[model samples]
Target: MGIDDITKKAQEFLGDDKVKDALKSEQAEGVSDKLLDGVADAANKVTGGKFADQIDGARDAADKSVGNE
Candidate 1:
């Protein structure tokens, strides 16, 4: 299968209700927070803090998507 096909399949799997529910679990919240924080931090460092605000906003949006307030 092509890379695009694999990506589409992965997206479909993640879009499933069961997968969404799993990502919304309380345990997932903690893990998501740590993961998002680390990603944002890494992004900020890579950009030399020039895009810190934007990166943080994007991180918050991603966190909310996983059901975290």
Candidate 2:
């Protein structure tokens, strides 16, 4: 799928509540990096690196949407 598709799917899977929780838990001093790394890794595994760029974009979008950016 495309970037938009990936982004929408990620947002749906994460949901507002989980995204908020992640943002809250990760917005702290040093946890965001680790959280984002985990997100990227999960995305990579899910997509098997076929849509790496889209996955990265979706992760960033999710982060920005939840105020982690």
All models: lDDT?
0.92, 0.71
TM-score of each: 0.83, 0.44
Per-residue C-alpha lDDT of model 1 across residues 1-69, encoded as one tens digit per residue: 999999999999999999989888988899989999999999999999999999999999999987545
lDDT for model 2, on a 0 to 1 scale? 0.71
**Backbone collision tally, model 1:** 0
Candidate 2's displacement at residue 30, Å, is 3.4
What is the number of backbone collisions in each predicted candidate, taken in the order shown? Answer: 0, 0
Q: Write down the lDDT that model 1 would get.
A: 0.92
Clashing residue pairs, candidate 1? none
Error of 2 at 63 (Å): 2.1
| Worst window of 10 by summed lDDT in candidate 2 | 24-33
